[model samples]
Target: MKVKAYITLKEGVLDPQGKAVEHALLSLGFQGVSGVRVGKYITFDIQVRSEAQARDQVEKMCQKLLANTTIESYQFEIIQS
Candidate 1:
């Protein structure tokens, strides 16, 4: 099974990188762009026979390593490969 995880900063958290991108876009004449938030996408294969097992393992991975959990939130999807 393949798992794709999306990790993002929680609301009310300041994102310096996102702000920099937004400023650059404005400078490049991209108009009316606001509330830019940057995030992480990770994809990997997990050896699991069932979706439930995969989900469980992925959740643990995110909590333990992939995401900050305090300032970041995460979501994942399972893809059979």
Candidate 2:
């Protein structure tokens, strides 16, 4: 199975990286972008038989190390290939 994790800053959390990107975009004359938020994307392949097991393990991984649950939120979807 292939796992794709998207980790992002929680609402109300300050993100310097996103801020920098927003500023840069505005400076580049992209005024349509009112706000911007940045997040992380992680992709990996695992040999899991079922999506349920994968979801369980992935959630554990996220809590243990993959994501900072204190200030960040994460969502993942698995693709079988």
Q: Name the candidate that leads on lDDT.
A: 1
Show pairs that collide, candidate 1: none
Worst ten-residue run, lDDT, model 1? 43-52
Model 2, position 31: C-alpha lDDT score: 88
Write one digit per residue (lDDT tens) for candidate 1, span 1-81.
989999999999999999999999999999999989999999999998899999999999999999999999999999988
Which regions of candidate 1 fall more than 4 Å away from where they truly are?
none
- Residue clash pairs of candidate 2: none
lDDT of 2 by residue, 1-81 (tens): 999999999999999999899999999998888568999999999888899999999999999998999999999998988
What shift in Å separates residue 11 of candidate 1 from its native position after superposition? 0.4
Q: Over the full model, what C-alpha lDDT does candidate 2 score relative to the true structure?
A: 0.93
List per-prediction Cα lDDT, in the order shown: 0.97, 0.93
The worst-scoring run of ten residues by lDDT in candidate 2 lies at 28-37
